[model samples]
Target: MSTATLPRTRSRSRVQAPKNPRDYVRIGLWIALAIVMVIWAMPMVFVFLTSIKSEADIFSTSSFAIPGAPEWQNYAEALATGNLMTAGGNSLLIALVKVPVGLFIAAAAAFALSRIRFKYDTLILGAFALGSMVPIQVALGPLFKTILDMGLLNNPLGVILPYIGFGLPMQVFILHGFFTQVPKEIDESVRVDGGGNLRLFLQFILPLSKPALAALFILDFVATWNEYAIALVILQNKASQTVPLAIQSFQSQFTSSYGPLNAFTIMSILPVLIIYLLFQRYFVQGMFTGAVKG
Candidate 1:
């Protein structure tokens, strides 16, 4: 071959590593995530196994042991019980009645705070924020007395009304942030186009705030559904008790029998979980949307 045109002569080759180091960092993150997920999932798995076990197998088996054969009977027992069925019915009814009332009140309050300037706005907002953080234990005595005075003490409405009241402060706080993020021009433009406050709110504001609304509804539903302590206090009648109240009574039986209790416990969690999952996208989006709005 001609000297200049000959195939290039081989020289000692040196290998250079990939320039980006992020590959290793990403791999490490995935590994950490996997470990965390496994750790988190262990308890859920244990609960499922426990639900299937007969009362005899609960303590007899190793604490972390899985059931050899899953018995589906426990779910039937829990679901078939008169008290639980009543409780579930009561909870569903309360949530149905209470959610709209809660949302309406919370949204209206948030809209006022977000859009209108007033002398008491900041003060009232602060009050609501502070009230929302107060531990429920502080209000128990007066609340019980108030419920009794209303003659609704032992019914689901007793619990539902209180849920709305106690739930409002946080709901307003959340919604206020979301509302403040609303474009001011949208409000002014609506007014310019002959829309009043109610029209602007119902036609424009509420539609734009649907994500926040959905998120709030789902959260309130879950919180009200799973609330055991206050429900135990207000709902005295087993026949009219909410789900959490029923779950409490289930504990008494579970002290002697685990099968039905675990099953019922799992049953109680499902509705809340489903609510969360169903609204999860909107929930997460609303959280980010409001937080970043400033």
Candidate 2:
């Protein structure tokens, strides 16, 4: 065979690695993102680690290191000692009752403000928005007195009623923005079909505003669940205390410990986290839609 015709094979294939400035920049960005993720995750990781550690280990060992044996009983002890089930039940009832009621009233008001075009519309909205700016602390004394006058102190209804009233401002504000973004043509079409405001709101408007409603409900649930000051003040009886108050009991004037408290905290956050995750897509969409449309 002729030398030129003979088959030639290379000993190795040359592979190129990233060498461009943009490629290096991409690599730098990935590294920075990873660092940020680690930083953000550390607190959550520490909480879980500390919750499963024995008190002795927690005090003797480094906060960053893992324990040899996880104290799963810490959760059980925390639950029993905190009376978490009762607190959790109270919180759940408040959320379930208040969320729907608040949403209905807010949605109706929002519909009137945005669609009906009644007199003093802007003035009404501004008044509600003003409530959002007023700190809860400012209202606590008056609210307490009102509850006392009404003979509702230490009652679940007291909390529920206040939650419904106080939660309305933000819910109305958000739903109004969402309701405004909805086309006017739809409302006119419904009216032309002989639909009244009630039918139109129930059949059309509420269905269209599910994302905003879910987002608002999730926010309300979390806020209501974690509320401490108002619950502490109003719920003088231990039986009516909510989860935040239960968590507070983990510390007393003479002694303070965080292991069992951390465990209860994790349990307390689970419901909120699960609900948020379930509705996360809608929540994100609702939030961004309100921002862009309004």
Candidate 3:
């Protein structure tokens, strides 16, 4: 072979590495995924690490360095320590008891807005929607003062009332859209079969809208559970404080202990995390179903 031809032959025979578009795309995707995973997981990892560190070690050690020994006692103390159990109980009451009431009222309003051609439907629904956009702090002071007048201050219902107010708008918006998408044939058939509005809503609409309602239920629960400002303003007695309040107890005016504080924060957030994971699919589907046109 000619010398130049020999060089060309070697180039043709050389088993080159993959440089195809698909292979390059896959590599880029994995690198992007790893970066994203690290970014998201970093906060959670820090919370967990702080939860397990002793106060002395937490103060002395570099924030980036992992603790030599994990302090499981912080979690125990948080659970068994002062006032936390009571605050946790209060949180449960507000989240569990108030969520159903909020859902029912909001769903009813949505149903009325979507299904009824009442004279005041537009006015009333718009009012509720408008209420959701105002910052909570804007109204909370006056709301609490009014609650005090009603003598419901330091009561579970006081916090619950505000929760319902704030939660209603988003709920109504989601549900009205969902109800609009329901086939009119179902309403006609129900009416033809001697069903009134009440029966129609109860038997058909409620069943059909369960997923949307479930999603709202979880959303409201988390909001109420984590709410601190309204709860602090309303609940004068520590006895009525909720989970966020309980977690706040970890920090003091003079000093905050990171180990116990982070531990308690982790403990407080764990239930919500668990609940979200368990019902994530339903939560996501309900939200999308409510938002999207059929």
Name the best candidate (by lDDT).
2
Native-to-model Cα distance after best TM-score fit, residue 248 in candidate 1, in Å: 1.8
- For residue 184, give model 3's deviation from the true position in Å: 0.9
TM-score computed on alpha carbons, candidate 2: 0.85
TM-score of each predicted structure versus truth: 0.86, 0.85, 0.83
Residue 17 error, candidate 3, Å: 20
List, residue by residue over 221-261, the lDDT tens digit for candidate 1. Answer: 88777777778778777777888777777787666667777
> How good is model 1 by TM-score?
0.86
lDDT of 2 by residue, 170-237 (tens): 78987888898888888889889999889889999999998888889789888888888788879988
For model 2, state the Cα shift of residue 103 in Å: 1.4
Residue clash pairs of candidate 3: none
Off by over 4 Å in 2: 1-36, 253-256, 290-294
Please provide, for model 3 over 1-294, each residue's C-alpha lDDT reduced to its tens digit, 9 standing for 90 to 100.
655544445356777877753678889999999999999999888888988988887778876678888899987876666466788788888888888988899888898899989898888878877877888988887998899999999899988888888888888987897898899999999999999999988899999988888787778878888898898899877778788776666566214657767777777776778878877888888867835454
Least accurate stretch of 10 residues (summed lDDT) in model 3?
A: 2-11
Candidate 3 ranges beyond 4 A from true positions: 1-37, 60-64, 253-256, 290-294
RMSD of 1: 6.6
> What TM-score would candidate 3 get against the native?
0.83
